[model samples]
Target: MSDGFECFKHVGLALDPIHVGTGGARLGRVDLSIVRDPVTKIPKIPGSSLAGVHRAYVAMAEKKYPGCAGQGQPDTSGAGGHCCDPKCPVCTVFGFAKGKDSTTGFTGLAAFSDVHIQLFPVATREGPLWVTSPEQLRIAGLSIPEDANADAVYRKSTSSQPLNLGWLLLPVKALSEHSCIRDELNKLGVPKHILDRFGVVPDRLFSHVVNSNLEVRTSVSINPETGAAEEGALFTYEALPRATLLFWEVTCKNPKHFKIGNKDIEAANNKDKVHSLVKKAYPYLEHLGIGGMGTRGMGRLRVLEPNASSNHSSEIEQSDKDKSQEARH
Candidate 1:
């Protein structure tokens, strides 16, 4: 079990909508559909998608540190062998392709789980409000705010009523006074700046909030010669609006016994290195993004790290420790 994978590290991403697309046909409606949960129909960033993006970014950043003797450059051939070196951070985290791998047996040490919407943004009668479902909060290991309640029509806030977001109206059905959800969110590690605008609503209203709040976009393929829209090239798509807070977890399997040649890999060292590299690569998400439509400005995002505002001073200190460890190597 010592070498088995476990949730050694956790990371969150607050995806800012810039017109992300995941292409899906919807009978006669929009030309493409943003990825959504099958049951809830809420837009989501798949874990696989996030994992691939992180791996690529890590690879991109490693270009500078190209471990040992230039083992950092990506396998341009899509052929393996280029990153066969066991100590290479990129291949160590994202396993090498079959038939092209580290001579010392190792599976990708990182495990990425799908990101679920934590605080979904919606337009209401009162500016903007972030909504969370009982189920969702449970999944994220978060507690539902006391001010929120479930109702036939909405999970209305008794103390803080919603005003106007877009077209929907949140009818306040609760009458009891309660504290704002911000303090609770602050304790849970959501930044104050973001929590100030986000609030917890009932699960009953989540579907409406997300579906109605989707950012519908239009695009066209251009004719290079004419410099105009290609004939019948116009297409419409949906995207999860900006400022959507989605969270997922990543587990690093410190495979200490994993041997490269005759030496057992240093699981702690490798774990620390991979964690640091991933954190170092986060700033790139704001520029690159995930999902689809990079050229059209879709997919830029910000990965949330544990920090003081999120009330994780200890965790941040741990990251600082990791940096120190990384520097030594």
Candidate 2:
């Protein structure tokens, strides 16, 4: 039988480029706003978001090195050559669109360890303003003139801050339980070494549910009483589960202030902090392969480390036998 449903949590993990300062952490705010139980107000980190961040990072890596990434490649059309049916091979197998010509199936944008590594490009006077200011103006259903001096309009609509390159540092508070990722390990029969090294938190669970599908019907008839036969069919589909989390961060820079020097200095400061945190979290990068094959791309799998720390360093250290095996190959 197939495995049952499972939920994962990030509990207590903090990813940084994290600023300890009052101003927004260089990496922004790490807010794990979703709790485990809504009634009890327990919070949990979402696995999907974690996966998404990893995928993004993968994509970023691919961009840095082209011809390095690709995804599952299956001939979508079936033997029958049917067109656009629900069970049609293309629609069912490939989903909506085909992937790019990259060699790797998985993009590196996922958050393997809830360690959020982000970059803030330098923002100029117009840069930060553009974040809030409209690139184009719109009034009612029609667009407003571009030359209409919309700066004032934007100011009236929302406050401004200098847009510049810098990282925001913040902490993410996520709760975990035994069931969250353990179930996956159980199915995969992960080795004891892997289980121990991965920092498996037994029974860490989160709240997530897929709702039932809604039903809708429609019928049409030509003449009121005279003519009358009608036929109908039922349409059914599953509703997937959706998850959400809140985020917040404090910053020293006033939203009202606009200083080039501050923006430049802050941008540089944040960038440095973010890179440092990323280096630290690099050690856990290999755990992303918890369930299946690790990182895959063009004829190669790059097992990497985020960085090192004395605290969890021993936890992720490799065995001599494993190292010798790796070296031999």
Candidate 3:
């Protein structure tokens, strides 16, 4: 069941932005790329990033609630009041939980929380450029804030916004696989109730391996023996890596099914789209701690519809023609 690809190496973040009008900005998109090492630069996406982002956001919300201190009750005296402190392993690697300490009343969370461990590196030009672009803003839903100025300040209060992780993780879901990770999870003594809630059945992981065909053309001789060949090429399709296919399926296809920890997630669910799942289950999602601050926070994910884009391009182009013709008539 192992693809021999055990360790997760590189993490990526791609983003897309939604512009309300030609002049006004509205939405964004984020995509992730994974790499085994810094050299080969071959990127394979991971699912943990997506899951981690959602989990981080949820934990953040829990800590931000009034009278709420942290995940689990910790001692009254600590650098950061949050259960998952800046010094805590979780906050350092994934995200930080910051709050007022009741005991000594210190401000910072030691060495851990202070450092923002970007799931994707910003050292490279491509990485840094992507982070600040409208695309990233769209993916992070930064363009659509609770209130322009006020929300920006509020976001500053926390290490990240509720949507930060989800936006960053969008690209990683493509390569999620169940190999040693699952085995390790079982070994960790995670209770069945918690595991089942993840909907991560070993067999079901197979569904994660969806298929995508890519067409590539290469030069070849039809009759090499005779040294005479046709100068034409044929179109052939091949299946992309299983992880790549799965990433598109969840993020680009049925995005509402995305998961956070053991819970169901739909960071992409658009509340305004009548046909969207987020709109359909708005009430339930809200009750289950899935509420967003503004209507824009309503789980609407703006992704690249490669297939749809190609198929409808001409149809849309012709529509413009039809409008012009009608005006003349």
Top TM-score model: 1
TM-score, candidate number 2: 0.19
lDDT tens digits, residue span 1-329, model 1 = 24455453243444556443465557646788777788887777777777777877776777723331233333667442445456666666765543344334445677787777777777665556666666677666655555456542233244455455466655554422212334445555566445545544566677777777788888999899999999988888877777777777777766574655565554236565556755655777877787677776678777665543554434544665898899999
Q: Rate the local accuracy (lDDT) of all candidates.
A: 0.61, 0.23, 0.25
Q: How accurate is candidate 3 locally (lDDT)?
A: 0.25
Clash number for model 2?
A: 61
Where is model 2 poorest over a 10-residue stretch in terms of lDDT?
205-214
Q: In model 2, what is the error at residue 2, expressed in angstroms?
A: 13
Model 2 residue 245 lDDT score: 11
TM-score of each: 0.76, 0.19, 0.21
Q: Give stretches of model 1 more than 4 Å off.
A: 1-15, 18-24, 64-82, 101-105, 145-149, 152-165, 173-181, 260-263, 266-270, 308-329
- Count residue pairs with overlapping backbones in model 1: 12
Measured with C-alpha atoms, the lDDT of residue 189 in candidate 2 is 28
